[model samples]
Target: MKRVIRILISYALALVLVIVSMNCSFVNIKADEQVYLSVSKSNSWESEGKYYAQFNLTITNNSSKNLQDWTINISKSGGEISQSWCCFVSDLGNSYELKPESYNKEIKAGENISNVGLIMSFPAETSNINASISPVFETEVKESPNIKEEDSNKEETKSQESVEVTEEINAGDEVETEEIDENLANAALVASRCFLSYADAPVIAIRACYDYMIVLNTEPKEEQETIAEAAVTAAQTASEFATDGDVESINTANNANDDNNAYEVSKDNEPVIEDSNPEAVEDNEPVTSVAGNKNIPTGRLRVSGTKLVDASGNVVQLRGVSSHGLSWFPEYVNESAMASLKADFGINVFRIAMYPREYAGYLTGGDKETLKAKIDEGVRAAANQGLYVIIDWHVLNYNPNEIKDEAISFFNEMSMKYAGYDNVIYEICNEPVGADWASQIKPYAESVIATIRANDPNALVIVGTNTWSQDVDAVVGNEIDDANVCYSLHFYAATHKDNIQNKLRYAINNGVPVFVSECSICDASGNGGIDYASANSWLELLNSLDVSYIAWSLCNKAETSALINSSCSKTSGWSEEDYSDAGKWFMQAIKNQ
Candidate 1:
């Protein structure tokens, strides 16, 4: 009886030991949980209008458990909520009340889930937004399959089955996901607000519609179609909200889009709207005194037009000293010096020659700030003296095309900054040469001119000919398309320059306005390098031909042709008494004009 009892006890002890060993074999796999979210705007604030904000959410799981049910909540402080949508996910099972659109995914252990879409719209005025999401939950964690050492080979088969199930669920979720373009939403908003009333309603509506069309054309084909449909719907809605003026505007807009035949019909039926009283129209037009007129020539230097006309409608003669170096040294062009030029020398215009690249160099390196300040000071000084300032693009080397993009940016900034000012004239290119005149220079010049016109349509733009601006023939050949364009040429008759007679005759006979934009003479032979006597002869001829001329250099001390010496003093050779020869000559030319 004692032996049997001991056997029973031993069996009980063995059972207890087996249970302990099984518990020790069970593994607890820790999950690596993480969440990621990001925010972005479709367009930056620098753009013209409001833009949309987009948010993205991603979840990652790194455990043996399958995460199922989850919730995400997004919040914002500013801006009204416009609309919201989410992607579809299918891991939570039918028991969970998870919204199909918001369900991210059932992330298996060591698997990652991602979703990108509009969580919500924080309207145009919102400045800040915040978002948060809850951790994923599962109905229950399944226990590992019971297997002995002999069943270890089945582990790979079980893993494959889990993967296939997860993939099938993800595939189902993907079908319901939708994407929306933020740009189209912004466009719809703009269209809705564009039209309000009738006196001016039609014109306003047409402009708004045209703007919308431009935006649509720039978008991708699919997006463009979407935007077009939205725009059309918005336009119809706007018509309903509009007053009687609004209806008229809509009709006008529709008429503008009509065929050419319709346009002709409208034109034919339209009554003449001319004023019977010329006095009424004259009252509306701007009037300027003949003496106060300082109209910057609208066309190129070579074109014959009334842009720089005197009171009699003849070509106006502009005699001046080329103060290109003054731009480099603003301190020299003080009130005293400008006073000297105006009161004593009678200089009418100042050609401020600027080396395109070198002048731009002042904006780089440590001298950037200083250079900008100096340039501004110089511009102001010239303006204060009531002088016409020629912003010359002095290109000794480097094709204009090489820096065309930079030039456009520079010119746009300049044109807009001084659009209404009549004192400034933009010289698009300087001294173009070689084949670049046709290939690089002309195109670059045209581009810069267009840029300026886009901002200030009336700004005077001067374009130079090739070969150091000595090729008047080239200037006549490749004419600019713009009526306001002007051609420029440089002259140094002392270097066996082109005959003044030939140049003047060609310019006058061909109806091209010629300005010897730059000239220097040192001797009567016309080949002794910037000779004063030779320059005087050319000047007299230019005066007789009703031509304009700007002396080459106001700040070179070189004997060849020094108007103002290195010390900013008048050259002794011209006039010792008061440095009045150049000044007297300039005054006479102004009087004649």
Candidate 2:
């Protein structure tokens, strides 16, 4: 077994402190080597003469020995990196140096330390990437060895010998050790924001490598005073290089170990540094805040070739559930709850069903300002959590034409407010029951959609169809020519199965963009026993076609579609014990997915 250890060099006087084995061409785990390095592309895309790729770097320990330290050289032939996360990276002339900080120095064999994601941008001329790792060693620092000045005579002799050995195993890279004696006493910034985000880290861990090793302990009580001070000082020096107002330069790496951070990724557009490393950037700072949200789309979404594609031109599918009318159960419109749905409940998007005509709805007796505020809150929370949010103008029982002025004004307000947010999707009409497609509903859609376009032109818009949004084929016949516009189609598993589904197939094949804005497992009445099997069938169909969907509702209204039971009062953190039968099924489905 073998492993590739990335040993970062600091310029100062010291001796080599490690031993390892090397192989011709590349180092692989076997003999004295115990660690190996490998990388794979998690996502890739290109736009505007630039290519973007997210690569995951994996370091596997395949031997019985405990590996001590390592270093790797990664460079693109004709490109430069925008930034990286999960570790500190220093730009080294032609290549970037990947090194583990104090907290990530140890490797217990067979256990993998993953979640090292790199975001790179390169010119169109660059078409290839190169990566390789150097020497590895088997060792663990059970305790620090004494090297008092009184033993300098012996230490100097050993140090000289160690330095000679380091040069032999270092391959082509130079290895040096600098004794960091500076104090971080006056440094007000976060020392190691990168270290703070380690999995299961509060104090975190750091390992010292090279010829003269200095092991830094995570336990502050151990009181390795000089090493601790050096770790903080070393981190401070690295963070000084953080570029101002550069979102691509800051680190927003969120891993399982950073639960102690207890905050959401920033979605604010104003320039503020989120953090150079894993530390929380002050609110409103332009910082790279990667919150481990793998579901968040990295690029703008649009319809192309009869399917939804992200900015990278890769067909993408989204799956999530919508909230019931925001008139009730407004408690879930905060950051924690929305984050809970994504982190704990496994949802990629949350739809805000803003009813314009219900009892407590916006257009009715409901205070328009209050309703709008709640909608704003929901969108912001979803944004902060790095989840997609759909702002729906729910029009049921009455045509959107009846509330034409109100709908236009509302959409214009929302679109303008969330104009810059890619997570914000606009659903102009929820259900245009019994309206004519090309004459009545189309004109109303034209008015509202035009209003939204006037504010946020690039955002994805979903228009409702006539007769409960089941007429997707109608949209295909007279489709909107806009670039990112999609038609809404809703379904109740127990009610409209094959008929509407068949129409959907025809519409999709004919090139109409469809987004299922609402769905339920029961009849249209929103109550009674669930048709889970039918719902599963619907899900399969949606998945097969790369169609995105929002399951109908996140309320406790005692309905088969309501995810929470009537007896449950908590807005977030609802477990299986708190779910209705339908809720249980949906939760199970999300987990399965």
Model 2 spans > 4 angstroms off:
1-297
User: For residues 1-593, could you state the per-residue lDDT of candidate 1 as single tens digits?
Assistant: 12222322332232211001011122122223333333332111211243334333444455555554344444434432222323322233311111212113345556544333332233354433454444443322121212123432332221132111111113244432221112222233334322110011223333344334332332212233343344556545444444533231122121121111111001112122221221221211211111222343432232346236533445556667665432233333333344455554566567765554331232111133333343444344445556666766666433567667767877787788667666667876666544345666678788898899889876667777655465555555556688766566666543322343465566556655556667655331111233455555666677776666676555433233445432333211223343333434444544455
Mark the 10 consecutive residues where model 2 has the least summed lDDT.
1-10
- Please name the candidate that would achieve the greatest lDDT relative to the true structure: 2
> What are the candidates' C-alpha RMSDs?
30.2, 22.9
Give the candidate number with the greatest TM-score: 2
List model 2 lDDT by residue over 8-97, tens digit each.
222123323232332222246455435666665543456456776555566777767544455656775566665464455778888776
For each candidate in the order shown, give its overall lDDT on alpha carbons: 0.43, 0.59
TM-score of 2: 0.51
Model 2: number of backbone collisions = 32
